[model samples]
Target: MFFTNPLDNKLRKWGKAKQELPASVSAMKEKVLASVKPKAEPLPKTKNRTPYWFVLSGALAALVLFIGQYTLRQINTPVADSGFGIASQEQMALSSKYEEENLASDMVTPNVTPSDLGIQYGEATGLGGRSYEDSMVEKVSNFISTGQDRNGAISDAREFLKYDYSATIKTRKVEQISSRVQTIVRGHGGRVDNMYVQEKHGYVYFVVPKSSLEAFKNEIKGLVNVRFYTESVRAQNLLPEKVIIEKSTETAKESLASLEGELAILTKEHNTRISDLQKQLNGVVASINRLRNEVTTSTVRQEEIKRDISRLSAVQQKLQRQITDENQNYNSQKFYLDDRIKNAKSEISNLAEQDQNLQDNVETVQGSVEVEWVSIFEIIKLYVPYYWAWVLSFCAIALAVNYFSKRRTIEAL
Candidate 1:
């Protein structure tokens, strides 16, 4: 092999008989290798080696975060497809149902109402009794409140005292009795509730409220003959007990309806458990029916059970008498037949003894048969169900009442 290196020629000239390379020469070879070695191809473009798993992981993380946010949003706000909020829906429904109803008062408010308490008090003074004029005219004016009403209020006062009045011992009608009667009543702040003519042709009866009653009677006194007639005056105050249970029950019903509506939406959209929803609907319907039955007014039923019982007893007595009569007749006939049979048996025995040859034909048969008489017990047994309808009706009413009371309590909550 021919070598092209001039270094080898120089090495041959200096070499005495082919000396082997020393350790230093090996070091020099290593240095030459270090210098001549080609550099590696820059780690095979490692920056571009982004792991497929890393990208996938990043996308997955972002998707998970997005889903989490969506879930949170759905929970916080129930945005319907129509975009109207629940409050708006409630308002619209209220308007449609009640026709621009006044808004319900908030729970936070104190007691407020339209009614005011009325009172009347007075002191008696001077004579044995106050003048009839003062009691009828002045008292009414003081008692009635003019501030409560804006419409022209009445002021009951006697404008005229002297007026025509006639008294008749005999029954008669005077064409013209008094002119001041109408004027006096009109002057006093009073209105007539009702006027009645007494059995006596000349007597008149008037009934009115507290402030108006006195004036009304006084006016009548002025109109007719002033005779000493029984004038009775009495006052009555009615006490009212108010129950708000109905309103409470109504509110609960509305809440239940709202819950039902939400449940319906869930069923329509998400296909939620239909069985559970149907069960709830059944419960609600049952509650409604129960309440309705409870609220139904019951009418008193009148029956003549006593009369029916009395009639039945009479029939039973008649049947007993007939049975007794039949028994007595049967006993009498049985006793007569028994006597006849005894006589015939004796006659047959005598015949047997007297005529031995004819004894074979002398046999006697004597017996009595009884036909049972029909009884009334069977008839009453047949009618037992018909009469028990009243009892059944009572039980039904009781059940309805119980159902209603329980349902009302539930609804009120």
Candidate 2:
């Protein structure tokens, strides 16, 4: 290698000197090339097994890649609701509950009730109460942080909103971070609604008091490295729904009150009618007693009085039957009306409960957190400039390729 130095040729060319080698050096070069070109004792012919070797190597590489990919997928897949790092009861229940509730809230059902009565609220409508006014207010709010005073402009003071926060963090301690998040949430007067954890990743959903949302956010920010943190906030205005709910509640209450009033009036009328019938019955009894008490000297007159008494007794029996029938009918009607009143009261109660839930949503904020395990290499990458890393990697690969090519060339010679 020292005999054929590349730098010697370049230096000779630059100095404008002769480039040809001496006769002795040329002869030596020829001898070396000739010796390497021929093998001793005429080597036996070998079969061309290179293709088979290449095929085998390719198959092995493919199998290795496939197994690696499958193992990675298995590692990344989330476990069941009751699996590691999960709040079993809370997570399972909330997962199904919130998914259904969200779907229901997104659907819009037309006002099936009479338009004159306004929009209907309850499970019948799937809980959608987004109106044109609501849309306008939402759009306007998106442009302005606060509202302005005007004759008919809506006020933000009573605007109800449901807050949702989401964040993704990369850290080595996924389970530890998940547990810490749960603790922090609880400490902030919140509860974890759902969670899932794996060796390398985790997820958690929680709700905290809106009054403590800022504090909760700051604490969460400190849990993991801020450089690997990604987050977003979303809010849904529920003022229009609240208005509709209030109206529905009021309507239900009025209906209940009306039914109660009708019940009272029916009771009073029923009593009055029964009282009148009883008085008439008493009068009939008095006449029969008086007729019986009277002294009759003639036999014909006594017989006539007895006949009149018998007729009055028959009339009294008919009146008693009429009173009995009237009482039975009154009881049936009162029962039917009372049932209706009961139903109305139940509907009102349900609406009131829904309203209270809405209030609670406004008082609290929902949050979702995702944690991922970041390896040491990834941590180093965060501080290293991306372009510089790529350049260095390319240089290393080029050097390896050049080294392999030179080795193969020398063996061929």
Candidate 3:
């Protein structure tokens, strides 16, 4: 198709008006045309192969996000120790003792009948029809069996065995899980002893009824994934220590009773001695008064009576001094008794506290739960392994849009 220039139309209109250009104008037009050579073709736009800084920035951001997510996830991973504070060696030994006792109970053979042993009753040189060792083993087995069967309930072994439970969880909703843990504990008629909640982590220590521990554990399981959860149950046999405490407490009580009895006896003796001394002193005073009266009324034996008065007066002073000394001695004895009594009472109180602690351990199950917070990015990475691919795709699209937009703008200009 042929195209007409707009300048051509204007020139035709000028010519139809019969307008004649001067020679100088014609010459100038020729010069102008010569000067205005055909517009140099725009240098072909070289393909802009510049690196997309924005895309690179996006990639760097994605890498940083990946690293951060990985770090967060690692932080949430449960430690090998489960972070449940370590138990003492003694406690660990006691825990192992329970297991050993259970195994021994299972291995224990039933008492061999006297008839099976071809020994009649009372023929084994004992009141019972069994050997002493067999009898002792039977009793121990029964005790062990009773302990295991109680399942942390009230029983003979309850006073001697302590139970504890610990668990840890990792989740994105740390605060929510912490609350749920407390709710579960309370629902089981348990009480929270300690709790710490924060944006990224939480800890809850609780004591639940031993009878409800299993149920509480079940509820805790619901709040965590198996992969992100850890748990431990420990049973420590406090029998030996408890027996020692009991013996000490009994001894202390006996000592206290003995001290009280001594104090009572000392008080009675002190009162009786003081009364006797006062009576003798009163008699001496009466005698001295009588002697003085005689000296005044009877002139014949006045000198003898005076001597008798003097002797009575001496006795009176001696009695008074003896009473004073007796009082001091009694006070010293009383102070000694009081100190002894105080010490005994204090010892008893301490032992009682220890016994009470043991009882509480047996009656309740201590539990702890640690909640580790997870970031949203970490959660996404956890659920989607190829999250970085999505980031890369986004960057690629942005780069393409930016490049095409610049191309369009340049073509328009």
Predicted structure with the largest TM-score when compared to the true one? 2
Pairing residues by index, what is the TM-score of model 3?
0.49
Best by lDDT: 3
For model 3, the stretches where C-alpha displacement exceeds 4 angstroms are 1-158, 169-178, 191-203, 224-230, 295-298, 371-413
Q: List the residue pairs that clash in candidate 2.
A: none
lDDT of 3: 0.77
lDDT (tens digit, per residue) of candidate 1 on 317-390 = 55556556555655665566456555545554554454442222222111111111112442232345354576
Error of 3 at 406 (Å): 45
lDDT of each: 0.40, 0.75, 0.77
On residues 1-413, what C-alpha lDDT tens digit does candidate 2 reach at each position? 64686887868777887556777997898888888756479777887677888999999999999999787554433333223322223443444455545644443332223332323332346433476444433444433333222211365456677888877677888999999989999999999999999999899999999999888888888987676665655666676667678778889888888888988998899899899989999999999999999997999999999999999999899889989998999999999998998899889889888999999989899999998787766566665636567878999999999999999999999
Can you give the lDDT of residue 231 in candidate 1? 27
TM of each candidate vs. truth: 0.16, 0.56, 0.49
The digit string of per-residue lDDT tens for model 3 on 175-215 reads 99999999999999999999999998899999999888888
Query: Model 1, stretches more than 4 Å misplaced?
Result: 1-200, 203-209, 221-229, 240-413
